[model samples]
Target: MIFLIYGTDKDKSHEFLERLMARFLKGKNFFSLHRLDEESFSESVFNGLLKTDSLFLNKNLVVAKRLFQNFAAADYILSNLEILGSSGNVFVFWEEKIKDDFLKKIKKYAEVKKFDSAARPDFKKKKEDEELFKVADLVALRKKQEAWFLYQRIIMKGGPCEEVFWKILWQMKVLGLIKRGGGRKLHPFVLAKAKRAAGLFQEKELDGFLGELVQIYHDYRNGTADLAVGLERFILRV
Candidate 1:
């Protein structure tokens, strides 16, 4: 059996992989597992699936994460799906996202599962907190828009105040709109604008904003950050 698991939630994705690992570990004598990631893909990728004990006892587990950085690797894997299937290989794959056409071809030989970022467990919770985050995010987004308008206004009017610029910057910081630059540098306003457009400022309030931002930057960078419904209550309380 072949499995294709691709999703934005890395935590849950790893959890699912762990569960699968547990199943194989139970009958240790029945299975032999091989795992690969981007670093090791080039070395052992073309070797295909390796046989375990014997046909009846040959349960194979192949797990790959972030295996394809370019179309070359993806094409290589796609081309070999049939060969793996013919060998009765059980493959498990995980990626952030895969192209529709690639997924279609993999589905023909594997039990394909698409795990969307929105479907992760406890992903949607605390309506009040979510609403608060949304408000914060909205305020941050507006400040960004306002900053652009102000920049244009300054250029047209031929002078802008340090105070006005600082005010916009402060607003962005408080609303968790700005991204800190490497070392002590500040992120460019334009870069901040792009990030806001990409829905990166979904966490609004002070506490939630910091927590979510850290979680996003580190733990679940691949996942989506949507404003939760509970944010409304938090906004009212604020």
Candidate 2:
């Protein structure tokens, strides 16, 4: 049984992992709980612990953290997801962030949960972002001037930089999906808008733009860049 709790909401994910461990330990006298981390991860140790239980405990739970950021551990996990899934012990992987491709493969082998920090805007964001979706629509209509104006208006009225940034990124993702003709899962109105926006950029351009948007958020989180400034620059560049 493999369980993967990941994404940008580290606090929530960590709390959830602890709650789950508590539930698993309820009414239990002796249980084996093993932990692995980026600096301490070892394939040999992980494998040994997975198959070996203490004499005093009948069930074992192995909780791993941020191993995906470690190249060796990541590669080992990618190659052994199936084995981990079928193992007798419960395997829990707690990650702050993981690459999309790696996450996709892990989804097939584990009970997965993703907690995004951006899902809830900060109180400083207020309700000014109510019209933020309009920015995406403006882009689809190729009204760069109006898009920039609306974004500026929202930001001036307490709209969060993270919210606006994610909105623009979402627009790019939708456009990219429509460009690739793979937005069958999107809402009809959104799909229509994306079709209009898809013409504004080539596939490679959208990919590059998306990558840069992700980097901007990462840099902002790491305190290396201001999200508002980065978003302003990106919107101007696009």
Candidate 3:
């Protein structure tokens, strides 16, 4: 059997591949499983493996990761799709993305699946993010103690620091713009929040805080600071 799994949602796609392996392993005759990730990947190696047979096993499983990153290797695999798909050996491809044209051609021989991270966010995730947005609102309200406590609690619960930082930055920017009378076109709920948040800070204070955020980002990129640490400090200082 041949499987083609590629997607922008890497974690989800990876979990799907793991499920495939588990499902295939449920049978008694399944022998060995081989994986080719980018670090150990080569077209020649893959081709040789495909031609080799297991001495004592009914079938071997081959999993290829990120092969599409190498154009020549990807083309070689696609060109031999029929042989690979029809062989007794099981083949699987896991990629983050692939050319649309090549995908069309490979669809004839492989069972293809895609999970697009760029698509609309999942509803459950949206609700969780809404909770974080309220945290951002607390920051805008200058409720420092409450925001800091919630931030730590959320991080402890596995919320992403980068997401939290960006959310707060976005809310602050919106509030700053509304304070300057640019929020007339915003949604009623959004405008109301912006206006209320804007009242908590002077224009100069907002600008200074934004600059501090920029510096924090620069420090992280230069390896002098960690994002989570910097974000915590930012919330505490605010």
Candidate 4:
């Protein structure tokens, strides 16, 4: 059997991986766990998959993260899916996203399951969910502080607005503070922070803050506007 778990949401992906490990490998301290790097991943996975179990166990489980860096590794794994089932060895592959071609090949011989982290519901309303969110948020904030300092340093050294915006976006993306797609909305804390920063703006101006930020992003991307100006406008009129 083969399982492919993937999603853009890291938290959910990690949670799913942990749950699967607990379910399958519980109380089995003899099971081997390997963390493979990009350079050695292909070799590690190949060897791990092909190894014979001596414990008389019915199944050998291999869990790999970010398995394939190139088509060759992916092709190798895809071709061996049938062998996995025949040998009673299960390969569990986890990643953020899989290419369509790779996914198709894997599905040919393996039972494929996808877990999307982004599809999860809002965590703020549930007690367990809220605690998880808070923990994640606190870690993110600490990381953001480091990036924020670096950004300020770069800006002081005459970095361009586009550069700053890119840095900011990267940080926000890491923090999961930015939403994607149409229905995606800003976090309450983010909105509150923005509103507080834009204390100079009137009540009427506040209504257009998000829309203007979107416009600013579009304009900046198209090279028609300066990111610094847009950011200043945003901070001044939030």
Query: Which candidate leads in TM-score?
Result: 3
The weakest ten consecutive residues by lDDT in model 1 span 226-235
Candidate scoring better on TM-score of 3 and 4: 3
Clash count in backbone of candidate 3: 0
lDDT (tens digit, per residue) of candidate 1 on 6-112:
87664456567667767765754466677766656663544635434256775677777777655666777888888767665566778878888888898898876
Off by over 4 Å in 3: 54-58, 118-238
Off by over 4 Å in 4: 28-30, 55-59, 117-238
Report, for every candidate in turn, its global Cα lDDT versus the true structure: 0.53, 0.78, 0.80, 0.53
Model 2 whole-model lDDT (C-alpha atoms): 0.78
232, model 3: CA deviation in Å?
Answer: 17
lDDT winner between 1 and 3, please give it: 3
Could you estimate the TM-score for every candidate?
0.47, 0.49, 0.51, 0.46
Q: On residues 1-238, what C-alpha lDDT tens digit does candidate 2 reach at each position?
A: 8899997765466568878888776785355777777898888898887776555557678888788889999999899889888877888888877898998999998999888766546654445555777876776556778888888887685455666777788888888888887999888887777887788789999899899999998776543576777877777677
